[model samples]
Target: MTTQDLTNALNALSTGEHQNAIKGIKRGIERESLRIQSNGAISPTGHPKGVGSALTNGHITTDFSESLLEFITPVSESSTQTLKQLRDLQKFTLENMGDELLWPISMPCFINHQDDIVLAQFGSSNIGKMKTLYREGLKNRYGSMMQAIAGVHFNISFPESLWKSLHSLKQSNASLQDFISDGYLSLIRNFKRELWLISYMFGASPALCNSFLQGRKTDLPFKKLGKGTLYLEVGTALRLGNLGYTNSAQSSLRVMYNSLDEYVAGLKKAINTPSDIYSDIDDYTSEQPKQLNKNILQIENEFYSPIRPKRNANSGETPTDALLRAGIEYVEIRALDVNPFSEVGIDIEQIHFLDVFLTYCLLKDSPNMDWKEQARSTENLDAVVNQGREQGLMLNDNNTPRSLQSWGNQIFAQLTDVAKWMDKAYGVSYYSETIERMSMWVNDPSLTYSGRYVAKLKESGLDNGHFALELANKYKQSHIETDYSEFLKPWLEQQVEQSNEAQRNIENADAQSFTAFLDEYFHKN
Candidate 1:
């Protein structure tokens, strides 16, 4: 589509008129889904098998490592096989973790591949003590447990050609800051509905919301609900959690500048020396201990630059104003855990539901709705989490309360229209089937396996640890209970063969010492 076509489509959605917004959302979902599907089913390289299904099972205690190891044993047998499989699983888990819990199946629009992302470091329980651990250098002293927080990374992507054209135009008449501001304004104007969709998705899941809130230090103004905190307070938790931590506005700019500088330097080097070996030399030397240290430091700088200075006060650099300056259009969703029950990290059906829900949020018209209305929506989300089926939430339309089931039905009805449009546009019959299956999950509570599992767990009164142990035992029994000797035979034989090959190579080598043989072996490879 031409830029104008895209601009017009976005404008239609952002009008915030009920029917117009629904039409715009329908068009956008179809277009975006088509673009992504054309690129290929987002089969990210590394993800644990069965993670999505496991999460749906509502059994949080299943050990991810056990299930992962089981899935790979049937596929390959190499010394590095286990490590390679684990890495892939972790990557998949991290990527699809947001599928069930957050809105908008796609990543945030502001994130580019090259943009700097940060993951905050704060212990699950004592934020204050965690700070103390870092302050007293106990992180180094205590090691693993002291460094308990998960680190999040941010990256951004943009249309490079369009960006260049815009940059050139700005240079003739405007400053860089002015150009960036104007560019973002245009981006928001075009993508606000999509952004709101993202916010709604993130806000829908209390479990995911807790991920951003439970581990932070913040003092923002908050709304309370009868001694229990409101969902907006959780949003505030994310704001405070990430304010000077993940995606610190100013730090990202510096990282971007540094990346550009590095890119320029590499370009200059390539221009000066046409030989392919010039780049290869750097790669070869990277393995050397001294060079490896330097490479590690560079990577750390690029990845951690956004939050490092704030983490270390002595660094004296202050955070950028980018986050505060921009309107709060999208909130990051971080609370998804890998489902141990699905063959893939997320199910295709669940992803389809996510698409429908996000589109419904974007298409819904009510920009003038007060904070009270927003709070009600947030409460509905919490009710879904805490007692979704038991105490069905009340959805508000223009300040009127409706049952959650009724609201869901209306949302799915819109999805049906989008599905019909997509089937016609993409010539895919499965599109309708996918949306239909998703609609069943919403309309028929019996199909909600996640909620059922939670109910079972509560009925059984099994604590998290015991429940996890039982699941892990089941996994072990499924794999290892079958003749142990037969299972180990293939792996052991492969290991023996590899060891013999290494021995032969060592025996034939002319190296004077073992260290020399090691160096030569690695270097040759």
Candidate 2:
């Protein structure tokens, strides 16, 4: 599809014929946060029992670390409803948590050592063991320090009606699933080129505990903050930069989204291709494995991208296989930092902006990006991650140097039109209002979340630890003050029991040995 395809689709949809389809754009959020002790250190406790088994609970689960809680909400059309579900999940967990507070920021709380961060245990089921083992591989490959950091994931999909309308508009002969997949790939390509704007606007990890570095780093030009914290004065999201979850292997990995076939083939090759560097991780003799296969990637999930084309895979299906089976169903955006200011970790304003920005991405002209272009896009994102608020930082835009502000403003200009279209589609002014509000951040950096967070840390005359500690306590108090009535309590209690039963069922259903299970899973058709 070219620029004219977008123009035709939008023009046709604007005539009110597909307003319901446009409004049916669905979204869900998977917000991750660390459970912290009262002193703001990463909690060493196991998953809270009241939240249910980390293995089988649909709403609540553990991420890489045992203390890192990931709360997921089901798909919803309304952002307000999604946020409400997210809040209910959090409030319910907090009510069950005994004196533990959810870390408000994306960067982790203080940990004395990497080993202090335990792998999230998922009971004794084969699938559960595989989940933990994959994380174990991550720890050996990249260390537990980076794995402890948290972020928010936004999952979105255009409705089937919208897809059907676009297909009809294009008059394409491709299968509907293939058309949907290609359209999402188009959106992914555009999102890659423009995701730097997201880091600039919503990033909130400008500062972190000095202990985070574990005393091995240099050359970031970070300033000391009140003795125990290190920070970049102009940094936007340090978590997205070199200091986050990265390794030397990732620099050499190239997983592209140019098409469904090319994307799947790239990942399939990575998982099957052995890595000389990783081969000797455990000598392949230990009863317990240190890493998964010593391959370039243990699984498709190991391929990290800011956004991914996704489908709801069945019980034993891989992500790529699921995509190959039914084409793309949705997209998962992994760029957002956990909002420190919001009790829910992400506010509706940000969601509104994302809806507009992502819709713009979907409706904009998208061309196939080659390896060189992907590298250029990566460089743009890294520049924004590191020096977004820097006074005159410029980025490479198709080899033409443009000031970050100018580039962002250009994107926002188009996003304004997208927002207007969305507003008309949804019958609300919030989308347009969100575009206007976010545009101010492009022209004025001080209003951005990371900028404001850094300013607050400085004004408080405290280290990152203390400032975060204050916010953690403040949010905990707010949760405490809100009456935790029993309306939501009984259902959660039932859910916990149900999830535990499900885990038992999974464990009971495991007829194969763990080794056979691993071999079968990796060697599955």
Candidate 3:
């Protein structure tokens, strides 16, 4: 697709819109934060019963570790409402726990060793056991320290009306679901090309406590701060780089995104294919299974990506099956870092910017990316994650070296135009306001989150651990003083009981043996 193609698509969207098409966009968030003790050690307790059952609660759950809490919000079109829900959830959690504070940043603070991080647990049901075992396999494959790292996931689905308008504009003969899936794949491809910009702006894990690596070998140039803190002068998010959440074993699997069938086929192949590296670990037949299977990836979630095409799965249905069943429902953006600036990890300004950026991704024409382009895109992301704040940083745009400032300015111009259409839909200028404010950060490195975090540490003459603890305490105090706004205490109390009862029902309903359940889950239609 050319520039003219983008113009035509935008023109069609504006002229063909009906019944507030742009206002129909639905969004939700899954934010993760680790629970830490008063002195900044990882909490050793289980998921708090007052919070709800980790296995059944839709609003609150544990991610990889029992201490790493994940907060979810209900779907809404308004960013303001979504954030209000997020704040109340956090406030409720704070009210439940005695004094445990949520870790404010992506990289954890002052962990002793890998063994100290505990895996998340669910109750007696087989599915619950499988969830815990999946983390066991992760611990066996990668260490627990990597699992402790936290981030925010943004899930968004375009309004069905907007999809209808686009489908009509294309005038194609394919089904609506197929067209939607293809359009999302195109967005994924385009996002991969420009993800470095996100890491530069929102990435906050530029520095980390020395023990985070667990004394692993590395050659990256890391300079020391006041005490025990390791940092790179020009880094953006080390959590996104080679030092964090990276898998060297799955380097050979380049999953395709040009089509849903191809993407599913790629994941299925990885699931079924056995690996010599993982085969040595005890698997499904073991008395206590150490891993799910001997494959390169035990399950779909293990295959990490910055974004995934998502469809809410049914009971016993795998992620790939859900995609093949209904094409695609929405996109889960896994690239966002936990911004330390906000108590909720993500603020409305960021959400507004995301709305404009992702809509711009859909409106812009996206071309299919070959292997060479994909690899180049990864290289670009690596450069930004490591050296985004470097003075005179250059990024490769399809084999051409260009200044980051020039590329960022070009993208923001398109984003501002897209923001106008989005704002016109809701009779509000929030989208344009967010874009204009963020545009300045693109030009000035010091205004970015990573830059400000490093500056704060330096100005205070404190290490990463002390600085994080201060912020965690401050946010906790703020939450304690405020009353619940969106979700009241009465509603939250009712939800906790409902979630626990739901977990009990699932446990009582399980009659089949664990072996049979696993077999049927893999072989079912």
Candidate 4:
């Protein structure tokens, strides 16, 4: 849809309506980190009890590795409230961490070796064992060290009221579930078409510890830094580039988001399909399972995409099963790199911009992506990640070629109108103000987080290890200096104790043998 079309639809949806689409924008953040010591090496400690049990805690959990702590905030409509909660979680976790510091960066700077990185250990329960086994499978398929890299997942969904309003505006005969699914699919399609814009603007990992390469051959023009750091002058996010979490076996997946059936079918096929390479691993017949059946995906979560159509699974239900049963509930955005500059890894401005951008994507016309368009998006993402800040950089906008600056300007121009409508609906100027400040990044690349970090590295001549250690220490001290919130202290303490009790109950209640448990889990497929 054109800009004018989206504006007309917004006007129609807003007329005689007491609710605003912007206010109903529910968002949650999942920020991941590796526990690091004062010297910036990955901490060998187990998950801290003060942080809460990884098994039962809804807010605090481990990602892939034991030391990699993931903090999740409950869904909130207000960006300020969401970020405050995230900060509170961070401060609480830091308080419980003792001498360990939260790694202040996305790309891990220091590591001992692959073997030094251990998979997260959940206790003796069948469910806990299954979770750890999944990580072990990932480690066996990829390497242990690769799973230790940190990033953030942004979970977002619009209110059903907003969707019903849109449905009424469309005068469609589709069921609510089908309508919502189709609408979200349209949003996903547009997101894929334009994701390079986000990568160029928000990408921050331009460099990383050289040890990440581990002798892999690459054509990237990398320059050596002090000690173990290697950098690319034009790189935007090396973490999103090559040396990050990826699955070669699953790259053949053509999970189209044009419709719910097609999307789910594609995912279903992948999870059921076997991988020849993975099948070679020796299954531990006498002992525990080494990896979940040598399928292309052990579960639906194994298929990595920048954005995912998510339906919160029921107890023991697979992600695909949930989507099939109840349709898409929300979307998970996995493209963003953790902003190292922010104490909590994200900020209000960025969240507001996403709200506006994603709203525009939904309102605008989105055609289904074909193979050619998908290939173009893949290439565009590579260009943005590798050399987005380079002068006169160009990306394909459909069949037409446009410079990054020109395309960004065009999007920002539309977003200005979107922001105005949001401000009017929400009765706040915060959205407009965010667009105004972020527009500067389009005109001046150096103002971008990645550009500034690259410049800082050049000036200081510090390796990734030294640079990140300094920031980690600084943030650690900052969190320490800030007084703990008296209001949240009791609740935080209760959550930790409650989660531990929940885990113990689950452990005590298990009736099935490990062999029977594994069989039942795979029966979902």
Best-matching candidate per TM-score:
3
lDDT for each candidate structure: 0.30, 0.86, 0.88, 0.84
Candidate 3: pairs in clash: none
The RMSD (Cα, Å) of candidate 2 is: 1.9
Taking the tens digit of each residue's C-alpha lDDT, what string does model 4 give over 1-525? 677887787678667773475467899999998898777788888999886789998988998888899999998876778887888888888888888888877888577687778789888899998888888889899988678888888999988888888888889899999999999999999998889888888888888887777777889888888988888787788777767766778678888888888988998888788789888764423375788677888888888899999989989888888998999999999988888888889877789899989988888888888878887988898898888899899999888989999989989998998888889888999899999889989878898888988988889999977888888888888876776543287898899999999999999999998768878777756
Model 3 segments more than 4 A misplaced = 1-4, 16-20
Q: Which has the better TM-score: candidate 1, or candidate 2? A: 2
Worst 10 residues of 3 by lDDT: 11-20
Clashing pairs in 4: 1-365
Those runs of model 4 whose alpha carbons end farther than 4 Å from true positions after fitting are 283-288, 485-487
RMSD in Å for model 1 = 17.6
User: 1 or 3, which is superior by TM-score?
Assistant: 3
C-alpha TM-scores of all predictions:
0.36, 0.97, 0.97, 0.97
